[model samples]
Target chain A: MKKSSCSLLILVLLWSNGVFGQDLLNLLEAEQKDENQYAPSAFMMTRIAFGHSTEVRPQNVLDVFVANRFWNTPEESTQSFVADRMSSRIALEYAISDRLTFGAGATTFDGLFDAHLKYRAALQRNGDGWPITLTLFQNMSYDSSPIADQSVSDDFSDRLSFTSQILVSKRFNKNFSLQLAPTLVNRSLGLSAADPTSIFALGAGVRYKLGPHVSFVSEYYQVFNPLESRTTFDPIAFGVNWELGDLMLQFMLTNSWFMVEDAFITRTPNNFNFRNPNLNFGFNATYVIHFKNKLKK
Target chain B: MNKVLLLLTTLVLTLSNDSSDKVICRQGSVSFFSYTSVENIKAQNNQVSSIIDFESSKIAVSMLMNAFVFEKALMREHFNESYIESDIYPKATFEGEILDFEPAMEGAQIRIVKGLFTMHGVAEELEIKTKIEKSGSTFTLTGSFETLVESYDINIPPLLAGNIAKTISVDFRFEYEPYEEK
Candidate 1:
């Protein structure tokens, strides 16, 4: 009788395993078709100080931005803290997917028209595998204004400049995230007649949350290129980001009047010494709109 | 040793028999709606899991907090990253008993479920009205309840006080089948 009862239990277990798993498989598959699929935004703000962040917006979402940069540096005299020379950039970005984002803008500085595409290459979870989040950013720009070296940049290709960066970031906790970006800028025609066509730089940024809607953000770039021949100083920025619903507003003290990666990374005008109070005060605002397609399944 | 062996055998038999009285739902669905004069917010999660024991009148449920999806992508992000903090509290769960519940062979009954629902690392006592539909072998349960967002310690800023409702309404439904140990 004991053996018979044991056999009966085994049969019930086997039957239930097959039945339960199969039924659940079917239900899960059916639900997945209509379920929402999305990932988290690593950074709260849209722009990580004149460059794209590792965070990618969700699909079918558009972000419109206005960034104003005042042309001055803190190393100058304190008489002109907020300079009158300001360049404005209006950019619009759309997320093709959770992994890829594309944007285009026009900067008043150098009459630059720029476009960029940033992709989230890999995401790191808290486990033994994949320790860091990696992102790839590429920006291309064309200076439409007249060039001093007309003989070198007469052609359209000569007017083009590109900046490619690899952003490596890690979210240490809810309050802090750190990022390191190895950047490369390639200009078909260098600014000076004797300058090299390409230059390399390292960029670092940090975001620390102070409240639910406010965070401290900053970024610095150190160029490895020769300082003697360099026409522009390295970029330094310190800012605060305020998030409210779908809108984000940012105010910063920076050293450049450029808002695109190609323009800002290679052509800032300030050093980190802060010898004087001639800091350029700027502000940026971004609003995101979501599009939903519910008419058809 | 012999007594221990006999006791183990008896326990295994009892557990095996209890499996027939135990109902499990792996694809249960839970949703919530918040309506205010200024705005209305809704989210749903279909990956919820629940189990009910007919003999013991016990009910338990668990679901991933990140699985909750909203109609708007930004809302979903805020729901996980801002409000729920899915990274820290990845799952929400509930364990409760049906007060004065008596199993029926093939009928429907109204019951009260008294339990502790835990979300965002906070737990609160919940009492919800539930409708249980039982057939020969299939069982279906549906319920809805109202709770305050502050009970879960989720802070809403004053700026958004008008957009989000003061009280939230939660809804749950599950269809259960006899559980298989394997």
Candidate 2:
């Protein structure tokens, strides 16, 4: 009887082990892991309105941008409608990696060609990890317009201007974001005698998301020292961004006519004050195409 | 002395039984497709985790939503940020029993599985017809099912309503190996 009881005990132990061992769900939970949780949708596009935002394109993606600005001065009577002068820009931007973007563009306003390289230094986290997103932007522009003024030199090196900026942005929530860009501009030939060889300006931008596909954006640039030889006003813009499938459109009213960073920040002649508004109507359209295969995370 | 030998033998058998009951799959594949008049959208995720218990015929699967790769980067962004809200709910899970299944079956056999599928913080009862095969100590499961977008509380904007279908088709396959603690 003792031997039989011992055999029954062994069978019971073996059978119960299989029935009550670790659960399948618990085993799956143990093997499941998490990837890095980065914040999403800081800004819809690479640009908030008229300037670069702290956003970069994904790797091996191409972005085509077409921008047009229309403005008319009350002093010019030759104009039939609101827009007597128009300037346009066409640009192509590509992402070389997850953190680096390169772009080149041509502008009709000053017969200028511009190129830029942007690097994303750090990205914000989804939670209490990282507080802000940081990006570095560098741009170079060459002016090829006919020498209309004798003071302006025709030397190719003299016509070149450069801009370097550190972009810092914080997305407070899904609907609101703010950005600040401390900018440095260098020009061999100044816009005016009072304009220094190097200019310092602070740029600010804000976005309020209305929906998943639309947002209201605005930007302003404040120069440290005003130009004395020619009257200049700080550049200010208000715009709305609308995103459709693969295309994004920006409708804006601004005081800056030039599309490049150096010219728009230092040489804007119009003021955005409501009393004597010198706002130019601008429209920008961007379309993106993927050139590489999708990579799994 | 004989009782002591029986007790030692019982402990060894119990440990062996526990190890043999569980199997795991680290690289299961799950893909979904949506067909509309405007376009066909599809995505696939290969890094799915799954485990099955032979003793109870229970299975469980877990997957990260962001791991799904789409043909277009923009579409992937929209799927995560706008539709699925992957940031808010990062993972989807399912746990259920494989009914009418024989682990000792030599070849592929059809089985019915009923489970609770959870995604986007919403849960629904799901039933799938699967073809299961057991060879040696390895098991492979293949199945397909249809799920409604509205049932998961996913909202599509009016403008993109025509671009997406009401029902999405999902197909999955998992090849499982005997589970061993790493």
Candidate 3:
């Protein structure tokens, strides 16, 4: 009887080991498979944009005339004098982390060079149960012309201006998104003496996606200058962006033909200020290409 | 003694029958790809997540929109900031199953899978023909499909009308393990 009881205990032990061992193995296998699944949180794209805008305020009329005189001959040429305009802008973006990215780009038109650096931080993500994003951006620019030195003080010539904008965006669906940004602009230029209280600006933008590769965007910004009474600096822009796989293109219409960095930082529309008019209207084109690096899990 | 021997034989037969009817896979992996074209631009996300369950034929997946890295970091930034609104809709997901998978075995075999894909908070029905294979305790599945942006209410701007493609292609691969009863 003692020997039989011992044998029965051993059998029970074996059965329990097999049953629990299989259960533990399955759980571990499931966890390992989950970890093995590659979920990339960062991506890259080539961005290019050609955009033009027109100023509608009365104060812009004189500025428009000066711009027209600079770009066109005084004669009434039937060629339809195109005023202030910009060509194409090209930029590259790199994801620094799951929630952060850094970017830089150059815009060239006529004889101007504008370069800028930008950083974007994702404050909240949609899947996190929030349908909104709050982003902060800072950008700066430099002019490569001696005339820029003569027209603006040395402090503003090759200086970095700061514009802090808070973007609140909501995705209504998979294809449509809209955002509103309220910004504060601080210039190193002599604007402190000329227009001390005009460092604040209000802006809003909207994006509508038509497909996997096509989207439309529109933005409007208004700047208030304390030095100039009854006349606010406002610029409105409209553009479309397309994605063809590895390549992308952007076309736009706006009062500011400056590079995106300049458009927001300097608030200079079409390279012309509120002092110059000519309904600055022009287009920009940009192209992007990507190289991928894959890491082992 | 004869009766006891007969009972032992019955118990052994039952255990063997249960073990032989089921197959098991131990280690598996899953991945996905997304291709999007807008206006004069084309972009793709090559790395995505995938999940598989052989016993239930259940699958699950998730992908980050910001993961669609571009050549230009600025463009990628704008894509997340201005275009896809990644912060507002950061991830896309899918949950579904393979139907009638009893015949799946240890070689490349084609099977029909039908399930629901939820993106941007909208759920849509999807049908895909997946290739399946079993090798040394591992099961693999691969498939591809296209989704229209409009069906999900994704709006493409008129200015970028020429750059983006109306349909986006998605590809996936998944490997699964055996189901163990607790």
lDDT of each: 0.76, 0.85, 0.49
Q: What's the true lDDT of residue A203 in model 2?
A: 98
Q: What is the TM-score of model 1 when looking only at chain B?
A: 0.90
Clashing pairs in 2: none
Over the stretch A201-289, how does candidate 1's per-residue lDDT look in tens digits? Answer: 99999988887667899988888873335557888888898887788888898877678776677766555443432367779999988
Candidate 2: residue A247 lDDT (0-100) = 87
- Compared with the true structure, what per-residue lDDT tens digits does model 3 show for residues A96-179? 443344445555552333332333434323443544555555554454434444666655443545556665555555556556
Q: How many backbone clashes does candidate 3 have?
A: 77
Clashing pairs in 1: none
Model 1 is docked with a DockQ of 0.17
For candidate 2, give the lDDT of residue A246.
Answer: 78
- Considering DockQ, where higher is better, how would the candidates rank from best to worst? 2, 1, 3
Q: What is the lDDT of residue B128 in candidate 2?
A: 98
Query: Of the pair 2 and 3, which is ahead by TM-score?
Result: 2
Candidate 3: stretches off by over 4 Å: A1-115, A143-160, A188-194, A226-232, A260-278, A293-297, B1-175
List residue ranges in candidate 2 displaced over 4 A. A1-27, A75-82, A128-131, A275-277, A295-297, B1-20
